[model samples]
Target: MSEKFQKCVEDFQCLNCGQEVSGNGFTDHCPNCLYSKHVDINPGDRANNCRGILKPINIAPKKSGYTIFYKCLSCDLEITNKTAEQDDITNFLITLKNQ
Candidate 1:
């Protein structure tokens, strides 16, 4: 049986940007880089074996906040995550545009 929303809170270093991330239970990505790891089959379950780096590609604005879109570097899997309070979406978009 697969579990959903396991609520695992752990600190991690970003593989892409080398940022030390402090996870708050719901943290699935780096606030500095908006990058995530493909570590869960379901939210917080950490059951996925891919272990891919999920790069932020785009964002969609919503009423509450924004939804971040990501694509896995290793497996090309696409996913979406809601923006965190500390996420630097503006800087990311600016850097993305400059690239």
Candidate 2:
């Protein structure tokens, strides 16, 4: 973890897909919808007040996993996050390609 990263484990419902998500101290985005909330300035810090919905815009493939790019709906802030192991990334990519 980065020095600024804090580990917080909390469950939340996915704002987009309404999936019940269980946090594993590193969970940020919803695995089902790949959408996250603008709640953290640093990972797990929850210091940001924008409270916007972070929509996954693009996916960058990596050797191990992928990096997900996002844009906040309310604040329009752009950010990137690593995909979790269980993330339904293929569906998102397919949806993106279709669009």
lDDT tens digits, residue span 32-60, model 1: 87999998777778888788999999999
Which residue runs does candidate 2 get wrong by more than 4 Å?
Answer: 1-7
Cα TM-score per model: 0.87, 0.87
lDDT of 2 by residue, 1-99 (tens): 554434378788999989999998888789987999998888678888787999999999988789989999999989998998888887797889898
Q: How big is the RMSD of model 2? A: 5.1
Superposed Cα deviation of residue 19, candidate 1 (Å)? 1.1
Provide the lowest-lDDT 10-residue window in model 1.
1-10
| Model 1 whole-model lDDT (C-alpha atoms) | 0.86
